[model samples]
Target chain A: MSLSLENVSAGYAGRPVLSGLDLAEVPSGSIVALVGANGAGKSTLLRGIAGLGEAKGRIVLDGQDISELPPEMLVGRIGYLPQALPQGSSLIAYEAVMSAVRAARPDSPRAGGAAAIEQVFDTLGLRDLAMRRLRELSGGQRQMVGLAQVLVRKPRLLLLDEPTSALDLRWQLTVLETVRRMADAEGAICVIAIHDINLALRFCDRLVVLGGGGVLSSGPPATALDADVLRRAYGIEARVEACSRGFAIVLADHALSLDHHSP
Target chain B: MTRHLTALQERSASLADLYGGFIRNRLIAIGLLAVGLACSLVLDVATGPSGLPVADILTGLLDRDALPRGQAVILWNIRLPYAVMAVLVGAALGLAGAEMQTVLNNPLASPFTLGVSAAATLGAALAMALEPDVPGLDETWLIPLSAFACAMAATLLIQTLAGRFGAGTDTVVLFGIAMLFAMNALLWLVQYVASTDALQQMVFWTMGSLARATWEKVAVVALVLAACVPLSMRSVWAMTALRGGDDHARSFGIPVERLRLRVLLRVSLLSAAAVAFVGTIGFIGLVGPHIARLTLGEDHRFYLPGSALAGALLLSLASIASKNLVPGLILPVGIVTSLVGIPLFMALILTQGRRP
Candidate 1:
């Protein structure tokens, strides 16, 4: 039982952003990184998987062919943290997390039960600030709260869009580490759309690089993080340094000069 | 060291316990609503043109054979329908207001902002002015039906304008304000065309009165309100998702446009029905939802029902107070609502500040 996309094509308003994309199998209990530049259709792919957008392909989960299911039923098995965390004026931190869990199970006993709620708060490290209003929190704190909300249900399939965009350095590391731990411990399939290439190389088991509305490359970081792939996708001439642990992409001076000269 | 660590853990556990206790204590709010309902019913029956004892009122309601004919007629035919209409109209307005707030994601949004009451008033005035000279026109049913139709038309117009302008809250509210002015002008034109008697009647009706309440009228209004409230409440989960903003709602698998349209239709039905019967009662829709939010927090499940109950109690109490304020004369219910609700809302604003 795993997640797979077969020859998927999707976009908005008849304009195709992702065409003929195929992923045979995404292993359960693994962190898969989706790396792309600004307009590389990474967000669109995640949206299609989450059933937020229309796609002309089959998305099979546990071999049940869930491509045609309504979003409410799909939500039971999948948890999604969108790219933006909306700021609600009146909702407090604890209430926001509770709402997400309630979305999955409107009448679930786990939502307001003392034991379940306490466990969520303790795991998220939100015990001290549980009573604080959402308007009072900083952007990074709000992002963490948003992430914790989707984790409340511990869904089988987790999709995150730019989860660490608003986080500070420490919180970024903490959040990525938590995502890794969640996938490993719970046997859940996790797909994260991340802009930080180094974090992707460090944490993800495999990388899917998208460029210009299609898949540029997909493989282990050691194989996919080559200079030619970076140059084509990011418009940058880069040097790939292979190390004992892994590899890193260092942008050359000419790439930096070209970036500065671009309109 | 172990004792100190245990003490710290105990304090954290106690704080979580307190948070749980506070939310579970929602029963207190339900109790308060029950008490308010009972008090309003007693006062509504007791304080009228003819004063009756509480025992006699209860006996009249229970055992129809036990009361005098005059008291029974006054209690059953007059005050009972009036009280019932007050409860229904108040509940509809409050529910609609809360739904609007949630749908628009703005605390200030209400049915009145969409010109619903204004359009209904204009429609009623037109019926009164234009149908008098025609052969055998019954104003009672014609006026309310016209009001309902016109209010629905106004709602559709506002929705169409919103769609054209990208369906944002600011555009919808702006269109509503424009429609209010347009309806007000039509109402003024109707007044200019009316005969002396017709004009006076229109003016009085516009001011609002529960004295015109009848059992049949209350039944129709009650049926419309009852149908709309549950349909609107069913959208509470969607409304909560929408409160997270449009993109968030979309990501959560909600069709943003469909949800907005559903809420708009429900609120329009509720507002049109209430305004058709009550003649544009103000402030209850605006103030009722605010009070509910302050007392019950912002969960629409609790907030919508709480607002309905609180609005019913507030308006019924206002009607009772209006009757008693002058010994022999009665003020229009709308006047009383404004006079009582404005100062109370002002006080609330001062105390709470502008907190969404």
Candidate 2:
């Protein structure tokens, strides 16, 4: 079960956001990191894959064309954790997760559904606050609740947009680790758009660096974090060094003046 | 480790426990409605221009032949229809109010807030002012038919105007208010042109009375509510998703605009039917749903039916209270509802404000 994007072009209205973007097949059961600057079309690429945007060209899921499928139908096969978590009024934590489970399977038996959703809550360590209302939860706790809904169905393809952007340091590591475990254990293909290079290097198996609405480099962390690629994509001079666990790209200075002098 | 496992078990059970919780809440609400309805029936029979004892009222209801002709006329012709009309109209308003609030995604949204009742009133006024002088035209059917038409028109107009301004709550409320003013002005025009007797009739209509609730009128209102309530319930999942927000609902396969339009139409029909027969009964739509939510929480499946039942009970109780206010001098049913509903709603708002 792999997802392939072939010559995919998409945009809002008539203005192009991602143009002629080509990528090799994304293998299942791997944590693939999509790293790009703001407005580099990282989010748009994810949205296009999730069938939440208009795009030209084929998005084949498990070798099946799914470009024309509506979001609801595609939702059953793909789970998307949107940038903003939904705020339900007066809904307790347990009720909120159960509602999402019901949405995915409205006719499932009560006991079975309860057990399945409970597995997610237990995994996320959200059981302690299950009876509390959403408004009562802290920001990190709320994000966990949001994550529980996405994982409840154990979807094949998971699309997460900046899942750690709103979290504290503790929650950020917790969520990234959870995503990695989910991909490994459930054989789910995970694509996360992340800003923290260190976090991605630690968790992601492969990194696809996007710039100017296209893939600039795609390989292991060491090759993807080369000085030239980092300088070209983010306009930063970076020293790529090896670590015991993985490679790290350390930002030295702005690479803008280097471009001017070289030309 | 054992304590942590136990805690996890408790938390897991909590989410699954809502089904039982929702059922228990609904049962309590239904029980309260039953008690209120019984009290209404007893009060309706006991108090009138001619007062009777509780025993006599029960005897009359159980064995109609035992009652005297005039008492029979009052019981069967006037009181019965009045009580039935109150229940039906209250149920309609309550259901419509709940539906509107869910669809509009605003706690303040109601049929009256959207100027539905005012539009119905304008239609009733037009019917009175333009009474056909033809020999066979009946005045009784004129108000209801015209009111239904006008209400539907108002619903379509509001949708179109709201669409133009973007379908946000603020824009919808503003458009509704503007329509209310425009309709009220039209109503005043009708009053100005009407004869003295006709003008008095119009004023009485505006005050909202169950005095005119005949068997035929009760049947119409009941039929409308019966159709509207079931239809509205079909959107329970969509409405529940809607509570999450528009984007959430859309992601769940609900076509938000189409669902909104369907709910708006049903609410408009319900409101128009209630107002056409009973005049502009206000606070039942506003207060009844709020009471239901206080008891049933915000889940629409429970909230919608709970609101309908509570509305019926509240309206019937109000009608009974108005009848008993002055034994020989009957106040309009609307007065009793407002007198009871306003303070109750204010208290709810105040209490909710104090909470997180």
Candidate 3:
């Protein structure tokens, strides 16, 4: 499936944060990273696409304009994980994921539920926490469970906002790696609003740099990320240099004056 | 690749086993609570002013001919209705409290938080103070009917206000609290200007006794509770998802706004019916859900019924204590409920290794 955005504008309380923005087709089986400085509408863009907040634009999925589709219509087709992880639930991780599955797919037969939930638990390595209460789990652990709740549904489109903000380095790579494998295996389109540029380059097929209330650049990471885009979007003097293994790495030199290039 | 597949299957099976065990434990707790409720019902029926043996109550339940006329009159006419009313009202309040807490996202929220009880009290006070004279309605039915009407009026007011603005949690809770204070002030106003006899009756009504219970009142509350349980069960998964947060539930395509409004409506019906029939039994609605959460976790499949059963059990035991505690004179069941509920609630809180 291909997803595209046309003249998408989104914000809260009648204040437009990202407006008149357009994005090219993001094909199925591709992972695209949304990278920008703070307050650059990375979350607004994702929330707009997810239909969580107020937005005025067309979000087309597979050539069908789904922007006007009610949230119930988008249940099984789209999954969005918010930046804030869930807290204060006494439900265990397994039950929480099961609740997501049951709530999203209310009419589905219950026979396949056990297998689907178990597979997600295995994929996310949350078997040990299946019986542990969410309130007892640490923040990073709860973040993993939150992702598990989303992943268990196997939505055609996955939108993750800051999925790795609470994780350690090991878990950070593990989560990204899992998302990458799932996207390819299931032919799902994954759009992650993330802040870590290098990690985005490492796992994502393309980068969409958002700034100035619109897209600054959009292409393969090797083409879209560079010194100029970084300086313009983030107001940081940075270098996009090739490492010994020929992978792109960003090295920051200094912060430029924010008065000129602030989004 | 085959070995990897086998290992994955094993891991999945083990995880399923663990989940099954957890579910089994919750089911067992539910079963135990049901059994306890049944035992408490029997105990409540037997412990009264005139000592009726448990053996006689059980035998008389199946074979009415077994007991003498006087004993049978006591069992069928007075004790049985009172005990059954206690269970049904407790269950209604318990279920209402569970939904109230879930929708409001507050552990401290109960049916009383919405001002239904206070409204009912005000209605009762007004009835006592004014002594309204209607041709068909009996004096016996006036207080409860008036109380039920006022409680439902309060609910409708909240519903309209929420629909006008938004049924967001903070807004709904704030409105409920505001209604509570307003109703209390109006009730005090009614009580202040009443005669000595009317004032005493108002005080007695607010204390909430099951002494006036009849089989008809018991049946009405039962019907309301029956209708509500299925609706609550239908939203079980969505309610469970909501415990994560509102945004989380909305992510699952569970319309959080509509769900909250619907639950509040159900809570209002249950609370109004309960507090209408049995004065203002406050403790069960608040503590029933807490007991369920502590023992059975937050899976609404178990937790909802668990709350109901817990409420019934707590109220039944309180009924027995009220009858037997001060021999020859039964304290108000509401007074006994607090006396019984607080100690058990504190015990559960202390014994549980963790609090969520």
Best by lDDT: 3
Clashes of 1: 0
lDDT (Cα, tens digit) per residue for candidate 2, span B1-356:
99999777665565557446756766877787778777876777566777677776678888988888788777888878888888889899999898888777677777798788888888887877777664565778787778877977998998887667666656767888898998888888888989887787778888889888999899989888878877877667567656666655544445677777778778888998899888989888888888887777666767888888888888888887897778677899888888888888899999877866
Native interface contact recovery, model 3: 0.74
All candidates in order of lDDT, best leading: 3, 1, 2
Among all windows of 10 consecutive residues in model 1 chain B, the one with the lowest summed lDDT is B131-140
Shift of residue B205 alpha carbon in model 1, Å: 3.0
Would you give me the overall lDDT of model 1? 0.78
Model 2 TM-score on a 0 to 1 scale: 0.86
Reference-based lDDT, residue A39, model 2? 78
lDDT of 1 by residue, A138-252 (tens): 7777778777777776778988999999987887888788888888888888899999888888888888998866788898777877877787777777777755665554444
- Which CAPRI category fits model 2? acceptable
Once fitted onto the true fold, the runs of candidate 3 whose alpha carbons sit more than 4 angstroms away are A68-71, A256-263, B1-13, B350-356
Stretch of 10 with least lDDT, candidate 2 chain A: A254-263
After TM-score superposition, what is the CA distance of residue B312 in candidate 2 from its true location, in Å? 2.3
Rank candidates by DockQ, best first. Answer: 3, 2, 1
Candidate 2 achieves a global lDDT of 0.77
